[model samples]
Target chain A: MKKAFLSTGLLLITILILPLFISPFLVYLSTEILVFAIFAMSLGLIMGFGGMPSLGHCALFGLGAYTVAILSEYTANIYLLLGAAILISLCFSIVTGYIAIRNKGVFFLMITLAFTQVLFLITSRMKFWGGNDGYSASVTANFGFGEITSNMGLFYMMGFFFVLSYFLLKLFVNAPAGKVLKGMMENEGRMIALGYNPKTYKMIAYLIAGSMAGLAGGLYIYKTQFVSPALFSVHMGAEVMIMVFIGGLGTVFGPALGAGAFVFLQNYISTMTDRWPLILGLLFIAIVLLKRGGILHLIQFVTTFGLKLFKPSRSRNAPVDKQVKGKEQAS
Target chain B: MIELKEVHSYYGHSHILHGVNLKVNKGQCVALLGRNGAGKTTTIHSIAGLVVPKEGAIAFKDKELIGKTPNHISKAGVGLVPQGRRVFSSLTVKENLLIAERKSTSSEKQWTIEEIYQLFPILKEREENMGNELSGGQQQMLAIGRALLLNPDFLLMDEPSEGLAPVIIEQIKNIILDVKKTGLSMLIVEQNIDLACCVADEVIILNKGEVVWQGLPNELLHNEELLKVHLGV
Candidate 1:
């Protein structure tokens, strides 16, 4: 309990302090990272604990955004739009997860990818959804149920959702069903042999993960006041996966850091080169080769080095366990 | 308590079991003995619904099992301790037991975490350790403990003594006999002929997907030439 308090306190400090030092552009970028962070965390719940490698998270995200877009087009009430988005997105995710989770591993991945790819193609060509041009939501204070058109409000909402997501997911992973899902990941055959069905656990995980992604997506579209097919692209799915991998998955908030680092690098480097993708690809190769764990890992490595240099003799009195505290090689 | 009649199963194009038949009365300890390539595992898999039979009927207390999925079959009260003792490696011993839980049907339930701990006290000691960290004997204990938590009436244990030390195997054999006192029926698939002969209420020998012999353990002992001729060990 003490550890949890300290972690939350540290998170609160970062949330309060980071915006003060950074420019509004960086604030906006980090807000974008917050949305991605929520998405990646949702994906990690299934991939890391539920053992379902879902590549169709963006489908759920896009569905949420499009649901809000279509509803807001018809009705201007912000409360109704938010409610409608949640419901519609949840329904869509449950249906998609049902189809996607029936098969085994790689097949599960392909099925999810296939479903999202189809959605992306339809969004690109469909005129009703604004096609590739995309739909811009109304953002007036009075025009749409006291909608906060200001960027700060949007950032606050994103951050709130990020914190909410982390806690909700933490609650879930500790639940009875969550334990079963983790057990399924460890050994499904044994689970079956022990008189427990693994399929139900998988399906539940898939649906919950889908709903989480949907909530994040809805928040995202509201923040941007825009909806696009790009939200459903394969790239979005890959980006979420990269966040999970880099976040040192299984630890809460790791994916958020991963998303922050990825977005930060992209923002700073794209200013210098038009071919940022190629450079990013090479960097990915280097990360895998270096086995750096992730950007947070790199940060840890450097921080330790700097701390050691600053007080070379201080460690003589300090505890050894404190140095590498909480740093573990995830299985 | 269990019956399989005219059970035929095929793996892809290759036919495995051909018109296999077996039965276990309540509290009966039946052992399915065979050579390495014989259909003992497949027969167990068929009864457990891990493999759908091409043609047959699997009835546990007169309810059909062949058409059901593995989960539904398990829910119907067939607890299988499968080959390889496939314990959930990432889960702790406590968690592995927790996942196979069934709501208590009786006001006085026979099995609880306490009850299972009594059955395999070694599991109680390693409750915090991950399943993979345990030795083979401990894992086998965990596997049995996990199944016992469900409190099923029948257990289908595959290869309980497949690769354990002799002493551990002796302990497991005692555990099996102790469990049988609860009136739980079993269809155990074992390669250990000595252990099988000692406790099995009846022995059924399968030679290549066909049941060639069925009798009491004493009768099986009397027919040692038949066992030597067929089992090859």
Candidate 2:
């Protein structure tokens, strides 16, 4: 517990001071990472905890982006835009989740993919929303404080939301409802026997994930000052899935770390070579083969290995060792 | 407190249960005895709403349960301890128990975490151990403890002694008796006649998706002809 606190504190301090040492472009990239991190984390909740795999999570993200874009044209009231983004995403998820959640396994995946495709088609064809060219309208609202005209101000705003989202999501997964969702994932029959409607819990998870994704989408538009039909594309959805897989599915902070790594790699590699995706694909394959539990598991393995190497006697006196000893004595 | 009237369940063109009827009165233990493929598990599944019946009515405390979902059935005060001890393999023993914990609506005493620890001391000892880390007997105890945490008026146990050793089966028998003393109605499906007779107030023998015999435990013990023909004991 102490170690977790220390690491969290260290991470926060590092992120806070990142812009001070880095270039303006890197700050912008950092904001992008945070946005995608929230997106990946939302997907992770449903896929990892609720055992409901969705291929159209980008629909929620896109919906939020479009809501913010359209709303910003009339009024730049940040709160209104954010609220509308979340509300729109919630409505979309409820409608889509009601239909998609009924199907299990591959069917669920297919249904979600179909829904996203439908949204993409609508967004691209609708001329009122700028059609295929998308919308790049400037905002007037000052996120409740003042005009966030500067990149640093925008970075701080993104950081604030990132921290808030992280804590909220962490609280959610550790709550009683979250535990039931995990139980549902493990054994839906058992959860039903225990008086938990799996569908209700699943729908709740879907809503939470959708809202979080919506928040990310709102932030995405604020950071880029644009909204495009590409936001709802299948490729973007696949990218978030890859990020979740690279981070670790169930671990709360894994997706954030995954998004950071993915954004950094994508940015760095794209600058050097057009074959960056080939390298990214190889890296994903390696991670999957070597560390099935993702980067978090890999980090854990390394840390434990380092600890054992540094303090062999401490490892011998570990609680697990004591348990084995107690069992041997009993037998 | 639970009754099934001519419950006819099907599994995609195959009629698994053919008008099966059973009952467990308040504070009573009724054992459904049958050989493999005799629809014993199907009967329990039907009660739990995992296998919805095609026809006939199931009522728990006079409320129709046929059209209700499994979770709704559970909330209506019916708990199921499924076959294979389907405890959450990824969760710890404590987590498994806590997730299933629900307050009893009736005036009956609630089953607290401490009480469960008292009943299964091993679980308390391995509170942090993952479900998959436990032994078969331990998993069965966890499964029973999980169901008890729901604080249900009726419990359905399917093959509690299917894969356990004789010693563990004996322990399970005592546990069932203790649970019965708590005034919870139970419908236990079992192939082991000894375990069935040990805790049951009545015995039901099923063959080919139909109840062929129903009698007192002592009556079943004395009727060797009935036992040999139906159970092949």
Candidate 3:
């Protein structure tokens, strides 16, 4: 636990010092990555812990963004806009999750996808929501304190929220409730036998994941000042899922690292070629084929390898010996 | 404390349990013995609410449990050590125990982790081990420990000796007896006649989803005709 804390602290310090050395464009990109990190981490909650692989997670994301954009026209209260967005997205998840969670595996995936597609059509086709063109928030981003005109200022604000969200999610994952979700994922039948309603826990996870995603969406619109049907696109939904997998399926902060890698790759590759999606696809194939688990597992392997090189070889075999002894004793 | 009256259950079109009636009075242990496909598991599942009965009433402390979900049934103080010791494979032994820990009422004796460790010292030794990493006997002990942590008033054990060696089966039999000493009513389903007769207060035999004979363990063991005709022993 202390090691995790130290590493997280080190990473945060790096993020703090990063903008000073980077260009303004990179600062903005970092802010975007932070926002998507929040989004991906939220999806990770359900996918990794609850083991409910959702295809339409972006529905909640889009709902959050749309809620903020539409609400911005009425009031400039950033708190109200973000809060309403979160609450609305949470409600949307409750409705969708209630129906979607009834089905398992492929059926669940299809239902979520269908729900998002319906929402995408409605937002894009309707005149009130700006149709395909989309709606825009105010250019000057102000959050009660003052206008965040500089890229650094926005990056700092996003970075703060990113850290906050990460800690909040970490707390939830460590809580007894989260442990139950992990158990459910491992064996729903066993969890049921243990006196836990699987659907109830799934819905709880869905609510938290949806609201957090909504918060990311709210932050997203503040950064881009634009909300469009593109936010709810099938591509967006699938991309976030990919982000979760690329980071690490079940780790708390892996999704954030994944988001950074994904956003960075997308931005970097797009600059060189128009067919960036094809390149990205190939890159993903390579990662899946070679890495097997995700970027997080690869990093873990590297770190352990580094440690093994430094430490005596005898210590490495200790756990294995213990496990073998345990087996013998058990038998 | 638990009663099942004329419980008929089905699996799709094929009916499994045919109006099975059984009861486990307070502090009593009933062993359900049957051949394979005789609906022994179906009976256990029906009581645990894993298999919802089509037409009949299952009452725990006189409350209807037929329409209740498995979780609801479990929460109502009925615990299940399911068939094949369905321990959560990804979870550690400690986690499996902790997940099922429910606070007992003031009237009931609370079963703690310490007590569980005392009961199964090997579990304490393998506390950090994952469920899948354990041997069959260890897994069975974990399964029992998990149910005990629920502080359940009644337990439904389905084939606790399903895939264990003779020595392990002997250990499981002793564990069952130990648990029975706690005054928790149990309905144990087993094909192992010796284990069943050893621990159970009364032995009930099922044939084709129907209760064929119900008597003392010694009586059943003594009756060669009933054993040969129904159990193929």
Candidate 4:
């Protein structure tokens, strides 16, 4: 109950207050942060819950971006643009998930990485895929509902997607099959012994995660109006891992928080100095050492401590004394 | 009935089983008695399609089962409770059973959720507890209940009593007998010779991955010298 209250309060504050005060540059950055948060959360659903760490999620993300970029270039219809991207991503996710799920742990990770790298090379070399120069993305015509080509309007769309994606992820983890995936992570042998074939369930999770990453990519193309080969880079995979860890591995809200903090750090540092990667490297280590779990745990600690200091045991004086007296009598 | 003939197996190049043969007739409780690393578990795995047999044939009711997947073998009415009680640790007792609830192949005798809970009453009480929350004995019972829910004609149990309390072991033996009364044949791998001799009708002794002796439980019990030679009991 307390958690729900806190989260809702934070949500209201972020929705109403932050955009009012923060500069447009920071808002733009926040928008990027939220998009990446969706991406990170999707990957974490597989890594943290399903115990399948993927190094090829960028492939799915890039696929989504390219799909949108390609379709939007040819077609002005918004629904068609989104439809093509989603369908393409879903197909890629299914195929990638099938081959990857056949292996366990490190092998699964390696095979996924191989698939992504192959995809990267394909995108870099193919002529129709725009080769290494990449493709120019175009915005949809709003289906004759006037041009929705404004930055603020696009921000709201991205924010809505972020919220939708987050809730969908929560629903999945709470479902019966999702619980089985968690069980598989804890003890796969036992799940098999129970006669619940985990392979099928895990494959479904991988596909879902991949498709979400793709959806995020599709939104990313809409926001930026460009799609590039670097979207599938190895560095993007590492950034995703960092995002999940920074947010707090399994918490629902952690991914968004991590994305906000991380993207802000990158933007702020890049403006101040060219040593942003160096700064990120140091912060990553400190977070691992200090928070252990992630920034989410640190935030939780601070919230509780701040509450305790402000209240200062004022409500418990009479009840506490009575409890002490009662204990004394019992003794 | 199930038969494994001249089966050989290896674990990453180390030969584990060499020329091992065993059979269990329908409605019989057969036990494989061996010390650690005696290929008893390996033999069960081979039959369950978990491990591939290099030079042998496994026939279940005279049907070839060598090249099939684990699910196919399971579908063929061969249920295995593996060496460790590998109950899904995050699932509740009820969820564990529900997850693997396959309808009985025969149209007339489907194993329902209530029937599984009836076989193990403790499961009904702890239906909502996570798999790891159960006691060692409870986990063992859950494992057996899980396999039985598949309604297999034959059950292969590997070390179901290991690490369990004696009282729990007795419960397991009783459950085995109760299952036996229902005409489900079992291949039991056990180091507990006393429990094996009690629950099993026939005992097959494996030594160094080779079958050294096979006889009635009474005859095997009477011959202590042979038991010591093969089983190191």
Name the top lDDT candidate: 3
Candidate 2 residues A26-120, lDDT tens each? 99888889889889889989988988888899999999999998988788788989999999999999999999888888899889999999999
Ranking by TM-score: 2, 3, 1, 4
Model 4 chain A: ten consecutive residues of lowest lDDT: A1-10
Task: Give the number of the best model, judged by TM-score.
Answer: 2
**Model 2: runs farther than 4 Å from truth?**
A1-11, A20-25, A313-331
Candidate 4 lDDT, A226-248, residue by residue in tens: 87778878888778888888888
DockQ for the candidates, in order: 0.50, 0.79, 0.79, 0.28
Estimate the TM-score of every prediction.
0.85, 0.92, 0.91, 0.83
B7-73 per-residue lDDT for model 2 (tens digits): 9999899998999988889999999997889999999999898999999899889989998888888
Model 1 chain A poorest ten-residue lDDT run: A322-331
Tens-digit lDDT track of model 3 for A13-118? 9789999899989998999999999999999999999888888999999999888888888887878888998999999999999998888888888899999999
As for lDDT, the candidate ahead, 1 or 2, is 2
CA lDDT of each candidate? 0.80, 0.88, 0.89, 0.82
Q: What is the TM-score of chain A alone in each candidate?
A: 0.83, 0.91, 0.91, 0.89
Considering summed lDDT, which 10 consecutive residues are worst modelled in model 2 chain A? A1-10
lDDT of model 1 at residue A325?
56
